[model samples]
Target: MAATSRDVAREAGVSQATVSRVLTAGTPVSEKTRARVMDAMARIGYVPNRAARTMKTGRTGTIGVVVADLGNPFYPQLLEALSRSLDASDHRMTVWVSDGGKNQAALDAIREGTVDGVIFTTVTEHSHELARALEQRSPLVLVNRTVEGADCDQVSSANRQGAGLIANYLVAHGRTRIAFIGGTPLASTTAQRLGGFSDRLARLGHPLPDELVAHGAYTHESGCRTAAQLLHLNPGINALVCSNDLLAFAALDTAKAAGIRVPEDLWVIGYDDIQQSSWRSLNLTTVRQDVAQLAAEATRLLLARLDDPDRPAIRVELEPTLVVRASSAFAPA
Candidate 1:
């Protein structure tokens, strides 16, 4: 028969209850008793039943992460950061992409109490599910996105400030005919970026014309199509500001196909300084959204919510830095 806590207690010469306490680390045990139990377990190769432990503690040690699309390169980087952060605290992550939090998988996980909490990487402004989750006081955190009226802990980069910086840079560089490509209108990220860019440009006495502003899904294909649309509609556009890096890449390719010289003729920049942005072929200048910091802060907020569900919601916004490269500036020496 496999060794049980009883066998461990027998080998350690301690009471079975003492062994249980040591195994669960629940009621503190004396160092000597803990050492003895641990030694015996190592010798007997005893593994505690996780399900039993969860039943007693009421914590499954699992976190749920919801994202709109894992196919986006940025999301994979975000997941890697979240995984590393969670692993450090001895927690596991269960991810739900595609439909994000709107689908049955996430609903089932929450209803079945499989996840201790949820982190939303993508939440639309009109997400009724998010509103319900907030009302239920579920242990939840929003990362990189926020719902309109939902009250929950949130972690994201300073989208408005970053976009403002880009606008200033482009205007100062003598790029007058500027255009903006935005993501979904419902996304807070897209709204903030567009707001900041437009506000800053207007403040500089050069507002973007309505025809110069276009919207697209946050996908490469959408980026290409939108870039073509902007260029086609406004042939005089000398600068293009993309809501995200993927769109910037598409603009780069479409501009090249349209026989436009980058930097020399049309300057381009984007947000979310993803890895591919630094590739020699692309060399995109962008606003850097620190995925690592975002993941760490979101995990910290989720863990805090887990401990105290009644804690007041908090928002953490990290500042973004501008990375200037060949896409928006002259090549460096």
Candidate 2:
């Protein structure tokens, strides 16, 4: 026979209402009472009926996380952070991987009433799909990306400032004829990074030429292909700034295959500073955005929004710092 809340309360010598309060986190109970109730639950093998609780509270206690590419190491890092933060709040995460914010799966997930809110980790700039999500009246927060005119809460790193830092580092180190490898142009992260890097270079009197700028899909293969083309077809690209660490890793290998000495013959830098960037073989110098902090902030914003749906949309941007490594050492004059 399944143990009910009544059974738990009886075993713990507490009223049914007291058990309800403890389970729902409604009010603070003394530690001793909490321990007694918990022990009773364990001994009786009591499992709260989540469906009944949802019916009462009108909240699923689950948050939907929409990611563009699970393959990108950056998204997984953000997901891990979000999961941990949400878990602390007694909320579980349900992940939905969309194809560049253009898939029916995300809308279906929302419509299914499976989650109380959503966290878009890959919201594209000027995304209609995100607009639809906003219209759906789902309490959602954008993480690491945002639409230009969307009325939604956002948490992200200072992409422009971080990219500018890399540009300055490359230029100050005497690397001329620099090139850029970008990910999805529609992504806010890509736009900000490309804009910042190019704008800063222009201000430094080294405007990037069209030939030196290439686009990729934020994949290693795309990075390898673009890098090979840039090195073989173009001329005198002394430095390459990739949009993310995965691309940078591919560029590193491609550069080596082409017999181009990194940092000595060519400098490379990337964003996100993923784990692979620190591996002994790569040693990639990249921009380090505090993904865990970003996720935590995003979770907080979403919960707050859920509490007060009419709250004004907030945009939180954390500062990003550069992590230097062997891939971007100062070039010799």
RMSD of each: 2.1, 2.8
What are the per-residue Cα lDDT tens digits for candidate 2 across 1-333?
788899999999999988887786659898998899999999999998888888887888898888888788988988899999999999998888777643346556657767888888887676666677778766888889876668889888899999999988877877867888988898888889999999999999889998888888888899999999998876588899998888898899999999999988888899998877898899999999998899899999999998999999998989999999999775677
Candidate 2 regions exceeding 4 Å error are: 6-43, 100-104
TM-score of each: 0.94, 0.90
Residue-pair clashes per candidate, as listed? 0, 0
**Residue lDDT tens for model 1, 15-133:** 98898998664588999889989999999999876777788889999999887887678999999999999999999999888554353466557668788898889887877777776
Q: Which pairs of residues clash in candidate 2, taking residues 3 or more apart in a chain or in different chains?
A: none
- Looking at model 1, report the run of 10 residues with the lowest lDDT sum: 98-107
Candidate closest to the true structure, highest TM-score: 1
Colliding residue pairs in candidate 1: none
